[model samples]
Target chain A: MKALVHEEKTGTKGLSYREIAELEPNAGEVRVKLKTAGLNHRDIYTLQRHKPTDPPLIIGSDGAGVIDAVGDGVSDIQVGDEVLINPGLGWKEKSDAPPQGFEILGLPFHGTFAEHVVIPAENVVQKPQYLTWEEAGVLSLAALTAYRALFTRGQVQSGMKVLIPGIGSGVATFLLQFAKASGATVYVTSRSEEKCRKAVELGADKAIDSNGDWHEALGGEKMDLVIESVGAATFNKSLDQLRLGGTMVTFGASAGDVVQLNIRNFFYGQFNLLGSTMGSTEEHREMVQFIEKHQIRPIMDHMYPLSQFEQAFERMEKAAQLGKIGFHIR
Target chain B: MKALVHEEKTGTKGLSYREIAELEPNAGEVRVKLKTAGLNHRDIYTLQRHKPTDPPLIIGSDGAGVIDAVGDGVSDIQVGDEVLINPGLGWKEKSDAPPQGFEILGLPFHGTFAEHVVIPAENVVQKPQYLTWEEAGVLSLAALTAYRALFTRGQVQSGMKVLIPGIGSGVATFLLQFAKASGATVYVTSRSEEKCRKAVELGADKAIDSNGDWHEALGGEKMDLVIESVGAATFNKSLDQLRLGGTMVTFGASAGDVVQLNIRNFFYGQFNLLGSTMGSTEEHREMVQFIEKHQIRPIMDHMYPLSQFEQAFERMEKAAQLGKIGFHIR
Candidate 1:
């Protein structure tokens, strides 16, 4: 099988596209012949932290395909069933958190950036017929994250004011669409005017410049919920945009990690700060249903053949893409 | 009428025991001849921020007494009804937060330190018959804060692990008692060994030293809920003690107001950081009922006559008291 493998733990220096031994499903596992796979920021982090001593790893967290073979004891799913992978492993239900030993696909386990990948049968869900292969491939990780962040953690409601900062990422775009689909008044911010305009075109009620004066731009209105992924650079500003007793649900720290918090202001304002990450298998299933019911489609930036993995990664590294980047694997 | 008055807004120098004009209740108001009043940390904050130009402010938030007069349109309660004042103003119901124009009793409005205090009739709740006048007077502010933090914001449940750090203050003591009353296994931390022992005696399951290794002390156990008030000094340590996806409710910042937060750790851990203050009128009523149901009583450190206000403030400023400070005014 052809795979995107990394042999070193630092940088993207050891990344390569080459042939790897094909995998066979173990008991309760299925071999997915991936039709397409998606790129995520997690893939970059995995590459930067990959251990050289570990086996050469194929890395990707999202994909859609058909089961080529099923191991013994796998009864609910059969060979030739179309499916998308739920990247989060071990966590099978909605919970306050993932249980011990929980991990995402890829990394220590081989992931979706290959022609074929073997995973636990439970991690496969029927691909929503409404989504194209490219959309379904990239949809699990980002869309599930957005679903939990917006609904589970943030408790966003219709007629509520919702804010999404740094709107170009896959998860942020999903938040914008999902919040709008839930009848929320969506506000998005971006450093690029074009991206802000595009967000507005995609159903955002308002788009503010990330570098502009937010207080003045929103006419001093505050959000009921703010989906925060940009950490240090925008954490305080995002918090400032929340109304008293509002909630801020965070899942990523793309800019930086540590931020200074004012305890006095927080308690006096009566705010809620919730942290979230990848969704559970249950949430993944619900996200697919939600997208289908809303007729929502993933925003695709570009798709490339498996051999062009470097270009896709480079585009993500530069933060130049506005939506999901994909690899058309066969 | 005698009251504790602050003539200026810097330090405690301007705070003095003085005579003030007697107040008369207006329509929908009642005047209470206070038997006792409670001193809270909010009094100190009020002293430090009070404006000299503003009318000399009586600085106490909690009190219990018998109503001596009722204004026009006030019919539900007659003179001689024993009552405790709910310090939270304008917030009549429980919701995500208090409505606009909400404020505590002591700053802009004249408050409970005086021999006679006039307020809207709605702020008065019947004093629990089981409590002493001293207990009822001091219970409102701190107990309401603790009730909201532990039960409302933290969502603490029976058999859950609860941690209350700096367990010597009025609010912390209430938290220890309330969490225990809720059937939670409560852990307390204090710099003073004596205070820790006192907390344990007051029904805490464990007492950890503030300067000791918490992880080692708790035998690697994590808390489901943490009531945080010491602020910058204990913020990170309290957060570290929480289990993944646990809640920490903060209301005060006696040590410092600002702290550094690692967004990555916060989000990945899926923690909930909530900011809460005094309870709503509804929560105040509920808290009173909860106290009565559990047969809880306020822990008093010292009781002084209104003329001895200086000594009481001095003790509070030095942090020498372990529980609610009071002024007996008969």
Candidate 2:
């Protein structure tokens, strides 16, 4: 099986497109003939700094394919069923905290960056019928993250006002759609005016120029919830725009990590700051149902053959893409 | 009527004991002849810096007394009824956010420091028959803040592990009792060994020294919830002790307001940081009921006559007390 493997120690130069052995399903697992896979910043991080001396690794958390075989004890799913694989491991149910040893598929375990991958059988969910191969492959990670942050944690409801900052990421796009579909008025902030305009063309009610006076752009309307992924650059501003006792849910810190907090403003206004990551297996199933029901077509920026994995990585590094960048695996 | 007032603009010495015009109940109001009043840090803030030019404000928020008069339309509360005042003004119901104009009783409004106080009839709830006047007087503000932070915002439940840092404030003492009564294992931290010993004697599972090796003292036990009122001084350590996906509910920042947040740690660990002030009127009522059902007695440090207001203020400002300080106002 052909795989896009990061082989060197330095940078993007480490990526090597070559053949790798296909894995067979273990007990309670299934083999997937991956049709498409998504590229993410996590993949880039591994390629740049993860040394070759580390255990053999395959990188890619989002993928869509057909189940080629099922292991012993897998009774529900069958061979040749079209499916999307949830990358989260060890967290199969909703819990107040992730179970110990919880991890995302990709690094330590062989992932969908290859032509064929074997994952736990329970990770496979029937792909949303309305999505294309590329959309289904890229939707799991970002959509699940957005779903949990917006609905599960933020408890967004109809008539609530929601804000998503750094609107060009895949998760941010999904948040805009999810909030609007759930009947919330959505606002977005992006450094690129073109991206801002594009978001409004989608279901967002308004888009603000991130470099400009975005706070004033809201015209004094307070947000009921904020989906924050852009960390230091926008955290305080995002919090400032929330109405009293409103919530801000975060999943990423792309720009920087250390942020100064105004504790008095936080307590006096009774604000809630919640942190979220991907989601539970139940949420993944519900997310697929939601996307299919709403007919949400995940925004994809570009797709390349498995051989052009380096090109896709370069595009993501430059952040030149507006949405999920991907790979055609089969 | 005799009242304790902050007469000047500088420090605790500005507080004076004087005679003032007796209050008469307005429409929909009742006048209470105060028997006991609880002193808080907010009173110190007013005495230390609040300008004398502001309305003739009497400083105290927690009080229990006998209703002496009822104004027009005040049918529920009648003369000679024993009651405790819910000191939050303008917030009459549970809301996602406090309505505009919400204020505590002690700033622009004349408060419970006087021998007589006229407040809206709706603000009075029957005092629990099991409590002494001193306990009921001091319980309202601290218990309300702690109840909301623990049960309402933190979503605490039986069998959870709870941590309260910088113990010995009125709020901290209440949080310890509330968490313990709710079937949580409560741990506390304080710089003073005597205070820590006092907390363990009051049903806390364990007490750790705030300035010592407190983290090591926990011996790898992670907190499911943290009630954070000490703020900047212990914020980072408080967060470090929380389990992944645990919540930290903060009500006050007594040490300082400016704290550094490690955004990566927050999002990666999926932590929840929530801010809560005083609870709603509905929560106040519920808290009173819960206290009565549990037969909880609020911990009091010392009581001074109304004429000894300066000494009480000095004790609080110097951080010398372990629990609520108060005025015996009869």
Candidate 3:
């Protein structure tokens, strides 16, 4: 099987595209013949932090494909069933936190950046028929994150106002679409005027320049919920735009991590700050159902062949893509 | 009628114990002839921020007394009914937040420091028979804040490990008692060894030195909920003691207001930081019921006559008291 392998000696600079021994399903596991594998910021981090491994490592967190074979003790899912992988490992159900031994796929174990990957049978969910292979492949990680942050953590409701800062990444775009689909009026901010315009085109009610005064741009209208990914640079500003008793949900810190918080202002304003990341297996299932119910499609920036993994990663590293970047694997 | 008054000329330096005209009930209001009034940090704040008015402000928030009169349109409450006032005005029900026009009793309105207080009929709940005047008088503000922080905001439950920092304030002591009553294993931290000892005697499972390494003291055990009021001085350390996806609720900032937060650590650990203050009228009623059910008593440091108001305020300002301070008004 052809795979994208990261070796410690070469690190990210020398990612190799070559043939590797194919994997077989073990007990309670299934082999997926991946049709499409998605690129995420995690992949970039894995590349940058590559460590020595005996046989090199395959890395990717999202994929959609057909189950090629099922191992012993796997009865519910049959071979040839179309499915998408839930990358979160060891988290079997919805919980406040992941259980012990929880991890994401593609780290210690071989991941989805290959022609075939073997995973626990329970990690596979039926791909929504309404979505294309690219959409399904890219939907698991970012979509689940947005779903939990908006509905589960933020408790965003119909007629509520929501804010999304630094809109252009995979999660931010999903946040915009999901909040809008849930009947919330969505607002987005971006450093690029083009990204702001594109966000508005993607159903954002208002798009503010990231450098502008958000409070003034919103005419002093405060948001009921704010989805924040850019951290130190925009955290206080994002918090400032929230209404009294409003919620701000965060998944990542793309810009910087350390931020100064004013405890007096926070308590007096009666705000809620929630930290979220890749969600539970139950949330992944719910996200797929929500997409099917809304007939939502994942936005794709560009699809590269498996051999062009470097270019895809390079585009993500530069933060130039507006949506999910993917690999067209077969 | 005698009242403790704050005038612009004298401020907190010269809070006067003097005569004032007695208040009368208006339509939909009731007048309570106060037997006891409680001192809170808010009273000190009001005194410092005093402004000139035709009539000086009576500054106190918590009181319990017997209703002396009821106005037209007030039927449920009657003369001779023992009652305690809910300091939160305009918050008629429990929800995500207080409604517009919400204000605590002490600042803009005539508060409970006077011999008589006239409030909307709905602001009064029946005083529990189990409580003495002093206990009921000081229970409203601090107890309600603790109740909301632990139950409504923190969602604390039985067998949970709860942490209360700076555990000697009026609110912090209530948090200690309430969390213990809820079946949680309560831990406390205090700068004063005597205060820590008192907290353990009040039912805390363990007491850690405020300046010590709390994680080491707890054997690296993490808290499910943390009630924080000490802000900049201990905010990061307090957050560090929380488990992944744990909740930290804050109501006041006694130290400083600003603190540095590492956003990456927060999000990756999946924490919930909530800001809460005095609770709603509904929560006040519920808190009273819970107190009665648990037979919980408000911890009192000292009770001073109305003429000794200055001494009480001085004790509070110096942080010398371990529990609620009261003015024994007649």
Q: Which regions in candidate 3 have their CA more than 4 angstroms from the true location? A: A9-11, A52-55, B9-11, B52-55
Better of 2 and 3 by DockQ: 3
Error of 2 at A206 (Å): 0.3
DockQ of each: 0.93, 0.79, 0.80
Candidate 1 residue lDDT tens string, B95-116: 7789999989988899999898
What are the Cα lDDT values of the candidates?
0.92, 0.87, 0.90
For candidate 3, what is the lDDT?
A: 0.90
10 residues in a row with least lDDT, candidate 2 chain B = B6-15
Interface CA RMSD of each prediction in angstroms: 0.5, 1.0, 0.7
Off by over 4 Å in 1: none
lDDT of 2 by residue, B232-255 (tens): 999999999989999999878889
Give the top-scoring candidate (lDDT). 1
How do these models rank on DockQ, best leading? 1, 3, 2
> Fnat per model, in the order given?
0.94, 0.85, 0.87
Q: List the residue pairs that clash in candidate 3.
A: none
Considering only chain B, report the TM-score of each candidate against the true chain B.
0.98, 0.97, 0.97
> Higher-DockQ candidate among 1 and 2?
1
Query: What is the per-residue lDDT of model 3 for residues B226-300, given as tens digits with 9 covering 90 to 100?
Result: 999988888999999999999999888888899999998998889999999889988988898899999999999
Which sequence of candidate numbers ranks them by TM-score, best first? 1, 2, 3
